[model samples]
Target chain A: MNFKMRQLFAVARHEFLNQFNSFSYWMMFVIPLIVVTALFKYVNLKFNFNNSNFINMVWGFSIPVLTFFFCLIYIGIIANSVARDKTSKLSEMLMSIVDAKEQINGKMLGIYLLLCFQIAFYTIFILILSKVMNNNFLFLFIGRVKIGLIVYSILALFVSLFMFLAITVQFSCFITDTSQISSATMPPMIFLLEFFSLSLLYNSVGFDGDNMIWIFYIICMWPPVGSTLTPSLIASGNISYLFAYSTLIIQIMIMYILYVKSIHVFKYGLLSNKKKNIFIEGFKFR
Target chain B: MIEFKNVSKSYDGFQAVNNLSFQLHKGEILSLIGQNGAGKSTTFHMLLDFIKPSSGNINRNNNLNIGYMPEERGLYLKESIKNQMLYFASLHGMKRVEALKKIKVWMEKLNVVGDIEDKVESLSKGNAQKVQLIACLMFNPDLLILDEPFSGLDPVNADLLIKAVLEAKKSGTMIIFSTHNMENVEKLSDYVVMLSHGKTVLKGTLNDIYNQFGRSKLDIVGYNNLQKFEGMNGIKNIDIINDNSAHITLNDVSFGKYIFDDVTKEGYLPVFNQHYPTLDEIFKTKVKQSE
Candidate 1:
């Protein structure tokens, strides 16, 4: 391979393989599955969502919740990985050898791939589980929903998680070390998810779409919020396909710009060990 | 050739590397000697283009492949040595086949006494340092920058490391290292650049620096009291190594003869050999003068 590809692959491979040595990676997948199984087992005792209406409602609600859930796990992982390199001084060594932009891009790509693979794995597991159980109506519920809208919504969720992961990686540039990782990931994560979490609750309540058309549209236009909001909005018919797509496209553009701009921040953060106000950091151009 | 022309780096009003100028030719081994925060690693960082200089320029022959071992060891300690080294090798644009071959060669050549698949944390401190050194060399970089490469190694491992470095130097790779160890600097450095608080304090070839001080180091042993040499003409400084041995530095060469003649008159002198100042003494004296 060429030099650029080699550099990218080197970083990407390291990021990808590093988790195989850690128990936390397995824990991340297992914890989510355990939570799902426990919640489902509890719900089985209390109520049954075998009916079409209940299955549809639960599906719609779970889409946004799952999007945020997986995205939050990924954000934590990506940020922790980025911050560890800096704290460990590996960034110093790695940056010296590889281009800073390539390092960040490679890591982002690697972690993003890991997320995709894990999600795919879990999806397949659930599918097989459904087949084995014979009583699982999840496949039936999915077949009844608008396939086009669900596909579009899943696409939105994917982009949303990608954007969130990008933002987390960006924040990691300012983090000095692992100790600052929580500060780097926490505020932005919780704050961004808070708005989405509330909106998700609102969407689940079966409110009249007419009351807050503008609010839904605005929320759908902003990312981290928009990614999840657009999908949930689609489920309830509060958003048009054109509007959702346009908002997502706009969010993608913004995320791309942030990524391009963040290359400078990546270089700046690794070189200086001094802690600074991260708010002012975003506006300053290197 | 790599040349630094009055390069200076400042971070938030604190200058990390001052207006330091040094040129290094290919195949030359230059050692940067300094204490903590002496801008040794900063200079290496500037060379790597991780951070730009606040002023001036560093010129290099285009697109040089560099392998750097930082003062702070930063490999994945929990990961297998093979995994981390392969990753580093590929980062330098080495193919997997070529990288693994070189990794094997270096592991054996550097006397790395562990399985390549072993986690780095499982290795002894000296063995880990050897693995790190191998990582620096396996890629066959055009320029190899090792910051405190021999810092944590035992004498045996240090010998192995020094041999590997010399072999690299012999093969025409320009090597630059930073260390507090004067003996290693004396052994490996073709030229030396001494940094104190981000500024180049003393620099030149081993011979040139020694000649600059004049050939005037008198090591006397088996003599308890040499009080007669105090405030004497031509005697510069006296450092007592122990009760029986003292290192006498003279400003004048003829004064050694005079002191020898005078001291021998009293008793039988065991050792009164005159030599050049060691790198350690020179370093201490230079650093002290600046302080």
Candidate 2:
């Protein structure tokens, strides 16, 4: 187990370095910065607001959009990471030495770490940017930064990222070309975006305090979609903290099940050259 | 040792490997020769447990370390040669320090001279292939499986690869690979398995197989009268090489001595030697026979 963990770390480190040095890495960070900065300035001038509520909204919305962007980048990286091996014929070499299970797990874990690093950077950048502009901006962006919200969001992000990692890993299995990876990943990214937008809209509609309980209940119990959105909703008083925590546990359980299922599909799919639908193929294993 | 006992595999409804049974012993290099869709790749897939056999069992000694180089070159084009090799080596349980050291040695030995940090996409096809080969061997697996390892290689690089394979064999690694090149098979294989239409058409030691096909040949010098042997009962085929020499094929070993005696009677002491069948000839004959 120690050896396995070490191997997984090595894989993650390699993956992070490879992406960090690439032109695409800079593009991912730069594009978001450009768009977010443009929006911040445009809204500040147009609204003439004293507080950075506009900037906070931009930052919050950017988090989910950033999630989509990172998910796409992650999909490309993971798919090509595996597909490049198949196309260049490196998988044959690697598979000769390592079994399928280790290869998939190592890669998924590596990508997860990379995602975490991106999130940390984004968080730090937002915090510092807010502080430099104005001290109160931090509270607006983090929304009171209570210990509970901080802890809950961290838990929520980890679970959400893990679920995404599993999906991307499974996507990598069936694809031999990197070009096809985006199509396989688009569905999950779209789902996350929908839930994110819906949750934000629901908060904007100004439901009464009593109505918040049912809304929170619905968000908490949902499977994969709920895992990411429920905690953010709870942190914002759109849902109860207790419901968010319980949902998190359920989400973890679902992630564990999906992880196991992904491994089975990964083992069979890696060796196969035949084209397949990702959802159908995954379901077949179950 | 690797054993496939009545192993079968199918993709969808199409059978790819059908009830194939074979044992690959340690230190032996086995060549699987067959045409496209003849179950060669399918067999390799089954060995790696990439696809479960529909029936029967494939039993290895244990979770023994094995190396594989598939026909479709698997490589990360965006990654550098050194980085790619290091990642693969790590998966095999090698520490970073050890993997790096071994990769350096292999790159040097394989004549991969250049910036190790250069992305694979920038390298020539041949150089990329060399890196791929190094990635497999760096782990020092007990069993090495290569699917057409020589495909797309120039003659010189192919020879170099063959030399490397031979050196690996000397270190007691059991090698199983498939190829269309008969010369390489003849040079490297102690045992050969021929597949046709998802079935094992031929399997045996190289010598044992060639010997079974029979040896027959004719040599002649200063003999223009090839018509004299045409009427002979033992002669299966005859062709005049030139005005002075003619080649003859005897129906059986018994006919060779009689043909020699007859040629001598004609006051022509011809030079004749029995020739063992070449792998190419045997492969064509067996495949045709199976069809």
Candidate 3:
């Protein structure tokens, strides 16, 4: 690999290890597994329900909720990590060795690797739980989940994660101190909470295709916001598979555009010491 | 070689560095001396490409390996010294084993009074600074930029840092450091750039800078004829410490020779020395003149 790529991965590995080695990160990783396992044990003992229908419903509800929780936890991680580099003043030294683009990308890549690990770890735990509990959760989940909705949700989930991560990183660049991190992360947090609310709302009250609300379609087609909504809408049978996939494509395109803009802000925000309005200054070309 | 050709940096209406020009060859140590906000850090920042000059050119190899220490010291306070050093080494593409070896050697050489596994927050202020220096030096960078490296260092620790820097210099690293400490500059620099309010007020070797000011200071002891110097034409000011000793400032360097005869006529003068102004004095004079 070339020097830039080497530096990028070095940073990524450093960031990943830094978080991975921390006690709190491991706590965050392990606690959820323990809680879910305990909850599963409780449900099995109380209801004695291990049927495929219950498993399918559990997954349908759990996917979006789990995603929301992942975004919530990792957003703080990404923002704090970025702000820590700046507040500690190590960003200047790193700037000499690696480009700002590399630093930002490396950090995001590092967090994504951790997210992957979390996902892999949870998947393994679920598989093991399924076997031990005598419930074929994966088989049932696969047999029942609509393939189109599955593809759309998988695609939307990843795209939404990247979009939220990109937005968090961009805002976190404006943070000069630990005190400013909460305020800097406010915008992305609001968006994430809104996306979560929309997902749960649509999942409960299915969209009506006959008496269509144009606004719901807009929400379902826009990126990040649309990421969960489109999959939920598709599952509700209010949107066609073609429309759902097309909206996924459109969300990807919007994400790319936002990625380009966020990268620009990422470069400027890392080095900026002045506490300017991110909404105004973030879009300004330096 | 790194060369700055008529470089200038301006922010909005303020000129942070104004038409600066200098060149640094391999194995050379150039000291940039200035007061706070005197553009020393700005010059370093431009060289490191942290900021760009608004005008002129800085010519250097695009791929030159550089190590930079900013004015504000920084380290991961919660990280082990070894971990952070390895992370920095990895950034420069240094092999892990080789970097570990260098870290051990540098820490010992700099007298860092802490274990490699010690978190940086556990180190004393001076030791932490040394660790920061080690991170810069261990990779053997081609161009090393240090800003105010001696600011808070005690004399002994400063001497240790000086020795380490000199070693780097002997190995042919082109070093550029900024400092408010004139003594360290005088001891370490092969070339000096003195700035005042973003303008280059003096630029040359220590000897050259001294020569420009001329040998206008005279020290004398056990001289009997203090009265003979009272009406001297070249005397700018004189303070007679006693009947046998005095310090004199000359209006012209040629006047040193003129006073030599009278001081030695006493037959056994213990001290008679005429010398150029000290770097500290020169620094004061130049800064005063610029202001």
Candidate 4:
């Protein structure tokens, strides 16, 4: 590999291993999943969705909620990593090797890898957990879930996760002190969390599956929350392919825009520690 | 070689470095000596392209690899020494096996107290500094910028670092460092750039600079009651270092022989050495004069 790519992956590899080395990172992965799974079992026990397409109901209900929760948790992790780099002056050291742009890009790639690993682990864990629990509900969930929708949802899920990770890192460059961290990183995540929480609740109410809630569907199509929300909707057959595909396309486009914008802001902010008008800067191509 | 010509930097209309120009030839060590905020850091920043020069330019080979140790230290305290060091070497494009081998060599040369696997946070301040120095030098950079490398080191550790720098210089690496310590500058710098208030007050080969400042000074030792030369014709100022020794600055370069003759007229001159001022003395007088 060339120096730039080598440096980028070295940073990414260090971060991936560094984060994985921490017990807390594992707790973040395991605790939420176990809790969510327990909650699923409780719902099954109470509502006894025996007649309701067990696999579809559980997955559609659980994946959206869990993805949003994980994203929220990860915002803190990714943002704090950036903040630590700035506060500890590690960014400057890395900057001497690679420009600010590659440093942030490398960090994004590392965290993205971690996120993918967590999601994949959760999938396998859930499959095994239901099998070990001998809960036939999840096994039935198979075959009923539209394979196409499941595939799309997974892709959408990763794209949405990338959107959050990129934005969180972008904001992290602006955070110089520990105190500014929450104010800088929290709002976007909380917005997604609130919207997704509401979306999950709205979906669970047995609204007629055939009737598309136009305005609600429009919100569901917007990234990055839509990336999280739309997939579950696809799994349960609530939204049409036409609107879902368009939303997915639009979400990817927005993600691409943010990816480019975040790289610029990250480079500028890391170097200057200046809080210039980001809105204007964001629109700038460079 | 790196040449910075008429380079300057400003923040909020306040000049941080002003019209500074100098060149470092291959294998030469240049020490930048100044008080805090005197543009040493700014100069290093410009060299690294961390901050742009507001005017003028710094010319160096485009492919010149630079290793820098910033005044604000860049280290991950929670990370192990081996991991972080290898990571930095990789960033500089050094192969992993090569970096690991170099790390061990540097660790031994630096006499680092802890093993490579130890976390940085667990190392003492001085040992941790050695680790940082290893990070900078292990990559074998073409140009090395060390910002206050001797700070916080005890005398022994300081000597160790001095050896490391000399070794780098031996291999033809251009080295630039900033420090308030005059002894190191005198010991290491082939050329010195002394800045006061962001402006270069004095810069040149040590001998040439002292020559330009003139050699009308004498250091005398073991002559009791040296106050006898207070009325000497060529004498400008006398600073008493102790009862037996004093530093004498003269009004003319040719007065050194006269002073020696006059001081010895009383008989038994234990030591009479006329020489250029010590770098410490020159630095003080120069900076004070500028102020």
Which prediction has the highest TM-score against the true structure? 3
What lDDT would each prediction earn against the true structure?
A: 0.79, 0.73, 0.83, 0.80
Model 1 alpha-carbon miss at residue B111, Å? 2.5
Estimate, for each residue in A1-286, the C-alpha lDDT of model 2 and write its tens digit: 7766766666677767877887877787677666645545455533324444444344335445544566667766776676655555455555555566677777777777777787687677766765665544434545634567567656666666667767766766677666776665665666666766765664344347585677656655655577656644553455677777877777777778888888777766776677777656644654
| CAPRI rating of model 1 | medium
Q: On a 0 to 1 TM-score scale, where does candidate 3 land against the true structure?
A: 0.92
lDDT of 3 by residue, B1-291 (tens): 999999999898998899899999999999998888899988988888877899999999979888888777689999999999999999999999999999999999999999999998899999999998998999999999998899789999999989989999999999999988888998999999988889999999988888898889999998866867876789988889998899999998888987887667657778988988888888888889998
Comparison by TM-score, 2 against 3, better one? 3
Task: Give a tens-digit lDDT track for model 4, residues B73-107.
Answer: 75788889998998888788888899999999999
- TM-score for chain B considered on its own, for each of the candidates: 0.92, 0.91, 0.96, 0.94
DockQ of 1: 0.60
**Candidate achieving the largest lDDT:** 3
Looking at every candidate separately, what fraction of the true A–B Cα contacts under 8 Å does it contain? 0.77, 0.84, 0.82, 0.75
* Candidate 1 Cα errors over 4 Å, as ranges: A20-22, A30-59, A171-181, A205-219, A271-286, B220-229, B238-246, B257-270
Question: Scoring only the second chain, what is candidate 2's TM-score?
Answer: 0.91
lDDT of 1 by residue, B9-64 (tens): 99899988889998999899999998899898889988988768999999997688
DockQ of 4: 0.63
DockQ winner between candidates 3 and 4: 3
- Residue pairs clashing, model 1: none
Q: Which stretches of candidate 2 lie over 4 Å from their true place?
A: A1-3, A31-76, A79-83, A122-136, A139-143, A206-220, A236-238, A275-286, B113-115, B217-222, B239-247, B265-271
Docking class of 4: medium
Error in Å for residue B137 of model 2: 1.7
Clashing pairs in 3: none
lDDT of 2: 0.73
How many Å off is the CA of B190 in candidate 2? 1.5
